[model samples]
Target: AVPEAADVDFSDVAGGAWLMDHIPWTEASHRIGALNATAEIARVLRIAMGEAVLSVERHTWRLNEGVTQVWQYFPADLYHLSARFTPNQGPHDQQAETHQQARPTDSQGG
Candidate 1:
């Protein structure tokens, strides 16, 4: 996971799971699209793309403030994507919200 890396220190966190579990992420936005292997992604993922690849970009917020951003890439032939959204409740539940699930697939099966 690529973090904003501004004021974050991961030395105390054992792994991504632990970090995520400890933080109360209130909101997040995602963009899923086909990208022909952008230069930065190509260099980072170390693959030469002959066709458009799947790119998932996400930005998460804590208490309505931006916290982290992450990007993931996958070959469309190898994977499918799914997401679930639930609004934060309890002290932050000022408005009613709906639960949503999104499943995106290509030629590959989930």
Candidate 2:
């Protein structure tokens, strides 16, 4: 069964085909009932895709026009998340060596 739409937990998102399954939902109208259904569907997507991005299919049968449409991309790569980390290296503590330490030549060292 689907969970509520209040609190969205992305970690529990399972990788699968959410759109293919819940697109033809009969209650996708502008009414309150339809709004609730849309919210539920979004919550599910957040869990399954592990991403809270909006994805609307513009080239579909009914849904068209360049509007907001939430869809799944993939598991979030910690490195790709610019919000938490920079592209320099790993976490804040683990940093990449900017330059190799100067080494002595064969004849320079005994």
Candidate 3:
């Protein structure tokens, strides 16, 4: 990717952006993309139900109310639930069968 732009001389290029003369400007865009992926991984680890929120305020500029809003992964609730639960519908069928067994008998002694 870097090499493609390296071949194009600034004078040969159509645009007149000041930073276009420097290669680091192109590199900076790539750097930002890499950081975004890392940030997403960090985000997933810290999320819980009803915890994430975005508060944007408009003043002199569209400022981020809390730029450092980050989360840590809490697997305790999910881990325990997964460990105790089986991935089958057999339990539901068994529960219905139990209800049938517990029905009141009319012939029982009063």
Candidate 4:
């Protein structure tokens, strides 16, 4: 259950928008990879094996409380992802920030 959403009414705006507006921003983690469709992915996305896909999983949290988890899949040939980072200038414990780019994958690969 979403403990953070205990008393929230999501009748006006979209649920996602409400979550973004109401929940405090904390941190998110992402995992991305190119893979063949798994059974679950095939059922949801109607994809087949040998059909390469780009999978992205993200989990977000507010301090120690888990907020949301999401997974997105795209045909590998139709998209590309790239990220660039500048060295962290903040405290040693903080992570470096990343700038991301998304475009069509080339014939060779992403």
Best by lDDT: 4
Instruction: Count clashes in each candidate, considering only residues at least 3 apart in sequence or on different chains.
Output: 0, 8, 4, 0
lDDT of 1 by residue, 13-93 (tens): 554565477675788887877778777766665556554577778988878777678888765555555544466546444
The most accurate candidate by TM-score is: 4
lDDT ranking from best candidate downward: 4, 1, 2, 3
TM-score of 4: 0.60
- Better by TM-score, candidate 4 or 2: 4
Better by lDDT, candidate 4 or 2? 4
Q: Once superposed on the true structure, which residue ranges of model 3 sit more than 4 Å away at CA?
A: 15-110
- Which ten residues in a row are the worst by lDDT in model 4? 92-101
Estimate the lDDT of model 1: 0.63
RMSD of each: 9.1, 20.2, 23.8, 6.3
Off by over 4 Å in 1: 1-15, 81-110
Candidate 2 structure quality by residue, lDDT tens digits, 1-110: 23332254445753223433543332232111111224455465333323433332222332432222333222122112213346676555553322223333477462
lDDT of 4 by residue, 1-110 (tens): 36767677768667678777888548888888788887877767655765788888988888878888888887676666654445764444545343334555579883
Off by over 4 Å in 2: 1-3, 14-24, 27-68, 71-110
* Model 4 lDDT on a 0 to 1 scale: 0.71
The true-versus-predicted C-alpha distance at residue 5 of model 3, in Å, is 0.7
Instruction: Work out the TM-score per prediction.
Output: 0.51, 0.16, 0.13, 0.60
lDDT score for residue 28 of model 2: 34
Q: After superposition, how far is residue 50 of candidate 1 from its true place, in Å?
A: 4.5
